[model samples]
Target: MSEQPVVPDVAAPAGRGPLLEVVGLAAYVRLGLFGIIGQHTWDAPDLASSQRMLAIGLRVGEQQGRLLAIGASHGVEPVELMRPFAGVLDSFEARTPESSWWEGLLKGVVGHGVASDLCRLLARGLPGDLAAQVVGAMEYTDDDERATSIVRAGVEADGRLGSRLALWGRRVVGESLSLSQALLTTRPSFGELARAAMPATVAPEGPSADVVAWVLGELTAEHTRRMDRMGLAA
Candidate 1:
C-alpha cells in the first residue's frame, strides 16, 4: 500500500489579517490628490490633505506589516483569511465614489472606520498577543477628528452636500453589512473566527441563529453610533 501524504489543516487556530490594503488604497488616493494639487496652484487644501494622508499611509502601512509579522509568528496566513473579503473593499470603493474633494474626504472616513471596526471585531476572539497586534494595526487616532472637520466643512460650505453625504453614509452602512454577510458565506474560516469570538452569554448549546442575530445586532448598533459620530442620521 502506498503511504498517504499528510495535509495540514488550513483553518486551524491561528492569527488573522489587517487593514493594510485600505491604507495602501488611501495612499494612492493621496498621491492622486497630490498630482491634482500640482496641476492647480489653488490646490493648497488638497496639498495639505495629501500630506496628512501620506502620514496616515506610512503609519498604517507599518502597523499592517506588524500585523502580518504577528500572523506569521502564529502559523496563520493572514492572506488566506483576507482573500474572501477582497470584494468588500472593492464594493465599498465603488459605492462611495468620490466626485469632489469633500466626497473624497468622506470616503476616507467611511473606508478607515469600516476597516478598523472589522479588524476590531476579528481581534476579539484571537489569542492575547495576536489580538493586540490585530487591534493595534487599526489605531487611527485622528480619524474621527479629521472626519468631523471634513464633514463640518462640507456641510458649512453647502447644506445640500451634507444631506447628500448623509444619504451616502447610510448606504455605506448597508453595503458594509451586505459585504460582511457575503464574506461569511464565502469564507468558512471567517465564520469560525466569528463563532469563536462570541461572548460567554452564548451557551455551547445555543442555536447558531441566535448567535448570528446577536453579532449582527451588535454590528448594526455600532454602525449607527459611527454614523452619529459623523453627524449623520443613523
Candidate 2:
C-alpha cells in the first residue's frame, strides 16, 4: 500500500494585515478539518478539490473584509473601496481550475452579500438619490456570469447530492446583507463611511422617486440573475 503524502501547512508571513490574519485562521481550520476527513476517506481527488476550494475561499473572504475595512476607515463609497480589490480578483482568472472554482464561489457569495447589505444599509441610512446610486452599482455583469459558472462546476465536482447546495448561493447573499447591516450599526467606522458616502438631502419626492425606483429595479433584476445562476428561483 502507498503512503499518503502530507500536505504542508502554509503560513502567512508576519505583518500581514488583520484581514489576512483572519483568512489564515479560517484556512487553517478548514485545512485541518478536511485533512482529517481525507485521512479517513478513499476519495483523494475530492479531497484535493475541497482543499483548494477552502483555500481560495479564505483568500477571497480576507480580501473582501480588508476592502470593507479600508472603505469604512476612509469613509468612501463601497464601490470606490472595492475597485482595487476587483482588479486583484480579475487577475485570478488564470489560476488552476480548482483554485478558480474555489475563488469564484467565494467571490460570488461575498460580492452578492456585500452589495445587498450595502444597498439595504443605504436605503435606511442615506439620502434617497445617493442610496439608490450605490445600490444600482451592485449589478452583475458578463464577468459575474463566468464566476457563477465556476461555482456550478465546483458544486458538480463535489458529487454531493442535494438541491440545498444550490440554494446556498442565494442564501449567502441574503444572510450577508442582514449580517452586514448589524455589523454597520455597531461599527462606528461603517457609520462614518455611510455618512461620508451620503449626500445631504431630504426624502425623495416626485422625480426623485422615479430615479430611486429605477435604481431599485436595476438592482432587483441583477439579484434575480444571480439567484438564477445559483439555481434558485424567486
Candidate 3:
C-alpha cells in the first residue's frame, strides 16, 4: 500500500485558537456577496443569464451559511458577527462600479475571489477544527468556474469586451487588495492572526514588516492565474 503523506503540524504555526472576529468577518463577506449577486442576477442582460446567476447566488447563500456555522462555537449569530462591518463590502462595490453587463459579471468573479482568498488565508492561524472549517467555507472552485464561464464566454465573443474586462480585472484587483489590507489593519483583534498567516520565510514582525506586501503579492498572483484561465490579461 502507498504511504500517506504527512500533514504538517499547523497547530503551533496557527499560534492560537480561531479568532471569533475573523469568523464573523468571513461570514460578513459571503453574506454580503450573496446579497450583491442576487441583485446582479436580477439585472442581468437577459432572463436566461439572470436565471443562471441566481443559481450561483443560491450557492453563495449556502456558503454564507457554512461560514456562519463556523461561528456557532462562539455562540454568535450570523447577524451579530456581520453587523460590525455593515457597509464594508458595499463600499468596495461602490468604489468599482460596473458600467456594463460584462463589467458586472467580472465584478462578481474578481471581487468574491479576492475577498474569499484573503479570508481563508487570514483564518489559517485558527485551531485545527475551526481553521479547517474556515478553509472549507471559503472553498468555491465550482462557483468560480461557473461565474467565470459566464464572463469567459462573453469576452470570447467580443474582442473589444475582452479588452474592457482586462482593464476592469486590473482595477478590481487593486481595489480588492486595498480593502483587504484595510480590513486586517483596522480590525481591532486581527493583528496577531494576520501575522500568523504570513509566509514561513518572513519573520513575524508587526503588520508593517513585509506582511501586507507579501499578502498583496500572493493574492495578485492568484488573480493573475484566474484571469489567465479566462484568456484575459491580468
Candidate 4:
C-alpha cells in the first residue's frame, strides 16, 4: 500500500495531485458539525482557538469539494453518490433534536465519535488512497478534541446532567446503528464491502448476520470508551 496522503493545512499546499483524486466523504461530517457551530458562533466561542478551528473546518470543506470536482472529471458526480445518505442523516438529527447549546456540542462529540470509529473500521479494505483519505478525515483536530473535552468537563461537573447526557449519547449511538442498518438494507454494495472487510471470526459458511454483529460489537466498544471519557454512562 502507498504511504498515507498528507492534506496540507490552511496554506493549501500546491501539487495535491493524486491526493485530490479521492473524495473525502468524511468531509461532509465536518460541515454538518461545524456548520452547527457556525450558525451559532456564540455557542462555539469567540476566542482565537475557536476562530482557528473554524478556519480549519472551512479549509477541510474546500478540500473535500476539490476532491468532488476530481470525481466529476472521472464522470462520477459526487452528488449522486451522496444523495442516498443525506436523508438518513437529516432524519437522525430531526428525530434527536438538541434542546440546549451544550446538547448541540454533545451532538458533535457523538457524531464525531461514532463516525471516526466507523471510518477506521470501514477504511480497512478500501484502496490505499481511499483509505488514506478516510483516515485523514477521521483524525481529530485540536478543536475536535477540545470540543470533546468541554463536553467531558460539563458531564464531570454535574452528576444529574451527566446522567442525562449519558442517555443522550446512547440515543445518538442507537440512531447511528439504525442509520447503519438502513444503509445496509438500502445499499447492497455497502453491506458487501463491510462483509469483505470483516475479519475471519466466522466460519466460511457463516451468515451475513455475523458480520453485522462484529461491526456492532466494535462500534459499541468504541462508543463505551467515548462515554467513559466523558464521565457518562454508556
Candidate 5:
C-alpha cells in the first residue's frame, strides 16, 4: 500500500490574537470529529454513530456559547453577527427535507444537543451584565426555530442594508480566516488538511466577491434541486 503523504508545518507569526487561538481550538475539535465519524462508522454505535458525534455536539454548544458571549461583551447583537449568513441558513433549510430520517437525526444532534449546549455555555461565559441578555436570546428551546430565526434575520437585514453590513461581514470573515490560519500554523496535520481542502491561492484575508458568488451559486443549485424534488419548482 502507498504511504499517506506527510503534511508540512506552518509556523504562526508572533503576536497572534485570541480570535486566532479560538479558531485553532475549533479546528482541532472539528478534525477530531471528522476523523472518528469519517473513518470508524462501523465501530461506532448504530444508535448514535460515534463518540465523536457526542463530542461534536458538546463542543459546538461550547463554541456557540463563547461566540454569543463575545458578541454580548462587545455590545454587538448575536443576531446581527449572524445576519450575514442568513442566506446560507435559508439554503440549508430549503434544501433539507423536513420529513427525512436524516432531518430528525440532525434536529436531535445539532438542534437540541448542540444548540442547547451552546446556549448554556454562552450564558456561563458571559460577564454579569451581559450574561442575562445572551442567555435570553438563546432561550428559545426549539433548535430549528432558533437556528432559522437567527440566520434568517441576519440574511434579511444584511441584504436590505448596503456597504455597512458588507463591511461587518468582511470583518467577521476576516476574523474567522485568522482563526483558521492560527489552527494551520499550530497543527501540522490540520495545516495539511486545510491545504488539501482549500485552493493554493487562498489567503488568510477577507473573502472576495467572487467567493461569495461561488457560494451563492452552489446554494442556488442545491435549492433548485431541492425545490424540484419537492415538486415546488422545475
Candidate 6:
C-alpha cells in the first residue's frame, strides 16, 4: 500500500481470471459467513442479545446482496464460481469450531474480519473505480460495534473467559490467514489476476511470489489492529 496503485492494461479486463477469483473468494468467504449470523441469533443468551444479533444478521444480509451484485457486474455468478470450494466453510469451522455460543460470537468477528481484510487487500489491484466498488461493498456497519460490545462486556464480566477467548482469537487468526494463503496459492492465475488488476504505472512490487507474502502481511497487520481495538489479547 505504500506505493501508489498500479492500473493494469484494460484491454482484456472484461474477463480476466484473477479479479473473478478474488471476487469469487470474497463472495465465497462471505457466503460461508452468512450461516453464522443465524447461529448468533439462535444461540444468543437472552432476548435483548438475540435482538441485537438479529440486527447484525440483517446487515450481513445486505453485504451478501452487494457481493452478489459485484459478481454479476463481473459477469460471473459467484455461486457457480465458488462451487469448487463449496466446503471451505465446513473445513474452516471443523478446524476452529466454537466450543460455546459466546465463542462463536468471537469467531464471527475475528474470522470475517480476516476474510474481508484479504479480499480488500487483493481488491486494491483492481482498477480505480472497480476497486472502489469492491472495497465499499466490504465496508463495516454499526452492527460490528454492536457485536463487539457484547463480546467485550462478556470478557469484562469474566477474566477467565477473556483469557480463553484471547487464545481462541489467536487460533482463528491463524486458520483464517491459512485459508487466505491457500486461496492465493491454489491457482497460478491468481498472481496473474492480481498483476492484471494492478495499475501498470507502478513498477512490479516485487516478484509475483512476493504478492502473496505482501498480502498476508497486510492481512495480519489489519487483524492485529482489529484485535487491539476490541481490547482482546493474543
The Cα local distance difference test for each model comes to 0.54, 0.40, 0.76, 0.60, 0.36, 0.74
Worst 10 residues of 2 by lDDT: 88-97
Could you give the candidate ranking by TM-score, starting with the highest?
3, 6, 4, 1, 2, 5
- Better lDDT candidate (1, 2): 1
Which clashing pairs does model 5 show? 61-118, 65-122, 83-154
- Residue-by-residue lDDT tens digits, candidate 6, 1-234: 555343321222344565566666677677666678787787788898899888887787787678778778767675555554566556678998788987898898898888877777778777777778878887765777777888888888898988998999999989988887776776565565555555455445667666777667778888787776667885
Q: Name the regions of candidate 1 deviating beyond 4 angstroms.
A: 1-45, 72-88, 202-205
Candidate 1 residue pairs that clash: none
Arrange candidates by lDDT, highest first: which order? 3, 6, 4, 1, 2, 5
Model 1 worst lDDT run, 10 consecutive residues: 20-29
Over 4 Å off, model 5: 1-55, 83-88, 102-234
Give the winner by lDDT.
3
Using TM-score, give the best candidate's number.
3
Cα error of candidate 4 at position 131, Å: 2.4
TM-score, every prediction: 0.68, 0.35, 0.86, 0.73, 0.27, 0.83
lDDT of 3 at 150: 84
Tens digits of per-residue lDDT, candidate 4, 1-234, equal: 255333222211233222222233344454466576565445554475356446645654664575465456656566533333343467767877888666766776786557556546666546676666556655555655566677777677777888788888888888877766655445444555566567676542467676677777878898887777777788
Residue 34 in candidate 1 has what lDDT?
34
Candidate 5 structure quality by residue, lDDT tens digits, 114-140: 223322332333344444544454443
Which sections of candidate 3 miss by over 4 Å? 1-18
Which wins on lDDT, candidate 2 or candidate 4? Answer: 4
